[model samples]
Target: MREIRQPGAYSYVYGKYEEPIATVKPGETVAIYTKDAFTDQISKETDRPSQIMSNPNPQTGPIYIEGAEPGDTLVARIIEIEPTRDYAVSALIPNFGGLSNTNITRTLNEPIPEKVWIYKLEDGVLTNNKRLSFPWRPFLGTIGTAPALEAISSITPYDHGGNMDVPDVKPGNTIYLPVRVPGAYFFTGDVHGGQGQGELCGVALEISAKVTIQFDLIKNKSINWPRIESDTEYMVVGSARPMEDAARIAYAELIVWLEELGWDKWEAYQALTQIGELYVGNMVDPNYSLVAKIDKKYALID
Candidate 1:
């Protein structure tokens, strides 16, 4: 096992195939310490987002995986996500979120209040006000590999899996991503103590955490988008705009995955119509993400 600490190495974008901070062989586990999405910009005293000028969502690393290459599959098994801080923060930025007028919504009304809420993580629960409390379910909000050709902002969620704030990306799940560059420059950050389905406010319980993940490689096995295999379900993720397009993309990838698993295309489609579940990962990101999932019991893969 290797450990990579967050001190000077960080990235604001997903591509460019930056140099690796560490290299590990397939099946090796690495523990990474990551910062929150705001890069710890907000504190109990902080009230506005403008106080921070640096690019947000600073990712940990583009750790090179030995034997991983373009056209292959990189399997990352999330072993654990433990918060390094006692508190996490969530805020409503002026021009961000689903309800607020964002850069895409283009509303003339004044932006929403830039309010910040700090939640205390204690005894596996996150509580702010006496009325607001929930179990602390830690997960990485951004985890992925480098794209084939372009440098994408860490805020965007695409095929290469940047900032896909899906709750299912927690421990006990293994995410399979397609390799687009040599060594599969894998990096991750944006740890969240918890988040709802839509991430409605464009923010979740952002916190710095230590993530333990094991990496593996599948030679000649490739995928178009990210796929997740959990204890009970197999899921395919698709990220795009117009919400419906994200759903379509997810279903399409699910169908392809089913076919690759030896099921007939039509049979797979039919099964999905009955058993598949569609989950909206994030509608507030640059690309809305959706997950198409089916229980392993119904997978019909021998």
Candidate 2:
């Protein structure tokens, strides 16, 4: 059997992930065990938000894949996300999310039990709304690694990984992050039981699960940011001042990425402008996120 590594079980800061943990040629599978994104707090009965703010967003690993190098791309294909147990799902006041408008009086003070975390998002099924209740969709809130530059980033999303609370990042998804230093210093945290389009409330239906992933490398790709191929779509993750500016950075980078894939700059820009879509990944942190998606059918993957 091929050896699998745990992300939290090993030591890696910024410069350390470059060191190899285990060697794997192309097409090898490595299973990894991940701690809850909250690092171990907030379960089905525990709804206290204070505990969440205190703990760290402990990620799983920096499993050094053999042959990974700087300027390469580390493609992490999520095989499965197994939940150890159920947990509560909830939303908070506007002060908690990206759309924090002072005048908005509606706030989410209710702590939904783990069993009923999801609601029918349709039409009038819910008071004044009609929709069929749907099953809960779980995801990881924080899922990036160390920054090539100095300065410890808050557990929020940046070109480097922090608290990127995107919901589509689920099982059977593939995350592609640029290799700044060697080995790709990857980390993941803030797993959620469920979340909306934008993690507007700062947090998601937080929970922990065992994340199984397969890591592969794309050499000489020279990507400077992180991207993903979720089960349903492809996206680029970026954080910056003023949400629009951040989005610019993300899409600009995406354009460069497209160019590398053989599109001219003008064509790439036009395509992104016409068909690309944006998502508010997180707004609670100082920097905000805007993830853009380009249909996988239009792009090439090496």
The lDDT for every candidate, in the order shown, is: 0.90, 0.62
Cα lDDT tens digits for candidate 2, 1-302: 35344523433233343444455554566555545544554443335545454544555555556677777887777777656554433435324455553323345554332221222222212111244233457677766655676634435577765676777667878878767666666666566666666666565655566666677887787666778776456678788768898789888888887887788899889888888889888766767777888886665543
**Which ten-residue region of model 2 has the weakest summed lDDT?**
120-129
- TM per candidate comes to 0.97, 0.75
Question: What stretches of model 1 exceed 4 Å from their correct place?
Answer: 7-9
What is the lDDT for 78 in model 1?
98
Estimate, for each residue in 200-264, the C-alpha lDDT of model 1 and write its tens digit: 99989999999999999999988999999999898999999889999999998999988888999
Clashing pairs in 1: none
Angstrom error of the Cα, residue 194, model 1: value is: 0.5
